[model samples]
Target: MNPLDPAGIFISFEGGDGVGKSTQSRLLGEWLREVTGRVVVWTREPGGTDLGRVLRQEVLHGDDMDPRTEALLYAADRAHHVATVVRPALERGDVVITDRYLDSSVAYQAGGRSLAADEVERLSLWAVEDLLPHLTILLDLDPTVGAARLTDAPDRLERAGDEFHLRTRQAFLDRSAQDPARWLVLDASGTQEDIHDAIRAAVVTRLGDALGVADGASLGEREVG
Candidate 1:
């Protein structure tokens, strides 16, 4: 079964650092399990598979590297992750929710590091075999505010400075704008509850049939809101 088939729903969360993507991903996974009783495969990029764990550590903590090297490493991890984890789960008709996906590569590498966006996009699409999410929830936040929200020591990507993050944020928005039907852009500055509500609404709208929920039924009534 192809992961992109209608039998499964693929959702990815994207945003700048400190944009609460992790929280939202977790919340949605729990909601789907409780309300819809469907298997939810919660995962992340560069760390979703065993190989991805080592690549993630190196990419995040290793010494500085060339932009092309960094992009290739990320692409490698993505390829492994999709093949070993994401694709199999989706092929089983599960809901695959990833914290980050190919868009992160496009925004961080191409937009932030001044690489050719189209080139980076092509590389990633080739790596993933053009597997895109059914819905991408983009948490839009100002880079300044996002930076301030980071309480821990900055990682290599995080320490790349404000200009890089601003460009990355714009790239996410631009991609979302280009494919409005496939993206749900929300303000990350909003309350967490509010953001999760919006995300849930979007997911329910798109995956109601797969989730086994009637189109007009109240998902909130089935689970803790």
Candidate 2:
């Protein structure tokens, strides 16, 4: 196992597309910055480093790629991200918050596209070198509700079909069910404020005193009213 710096904490947020991961991640990143003493680095899989960003565009939006090829591309991006961004940050004792991680591949490729889950898991482990986040927060929302949250035209995977997203959503929830220790399911049907509060609570509970954010402080507690 690679050494984790005493101050390092890795937390990942996950969900199907349009589940407000981006928004919630940003909110939590800011909260961590203000409340925690450790250096906080915010990034995402498939696009954290420069190389990963280019691959992200090609992988997520490229409609011509084969399913197996797509899975490999995602793994490739994660390799770069884990090495170039995630590992180094953890070594530096920084708190790293990623918008998504390996679970996304299991949910999107294997569960959504009906590919073999074991293959995806094997590839992901090879890519990430078994580096698991200290905590993974899964935002749970219905496929239709999630799809409705998208304002712009959907991308290739986003447009895969309602059934595809339904499977993807269930995949994330199932993942949480299987690993209740490291994963938590956050209901996403509430208002943004409510959802954010729930996320902060989950983080505080999971991270405990390590986050330095106090057990009872709402995310709103950091905001200027």
Task: Compute each candidate's TM-score over C-alphas.
Answer: 0.94, 0.92
**lDDT to native, each model:** 0.89, 0.85
The top-ranked prediction according to lDDT is: 1
lDDT tens per residue, model 1, 1-225 = 223967778999999999999999999998888777779999999799889999999999999999999999999999999888888888888899999999999999998997999999999998989999988999999999988888989989999988899899999999999999888999999999988888887777887766776555454545323
**Cα RMSD, model 1:** 2.7
Q: Tell me the deviation in Å of residue 131 in model 1.
A: 0.5
| Pairs with steric clashes in candidate 2 | none
Candidate 2, residues 1-225, lDDT tens digits: the string is 534555689989999877889898888888877766567899998889899989988986766777899999999999889998998999887889999999999999999986988889889988988888888989889988888889988888887898988888888888899989899888888888888888888888878567666677764443222
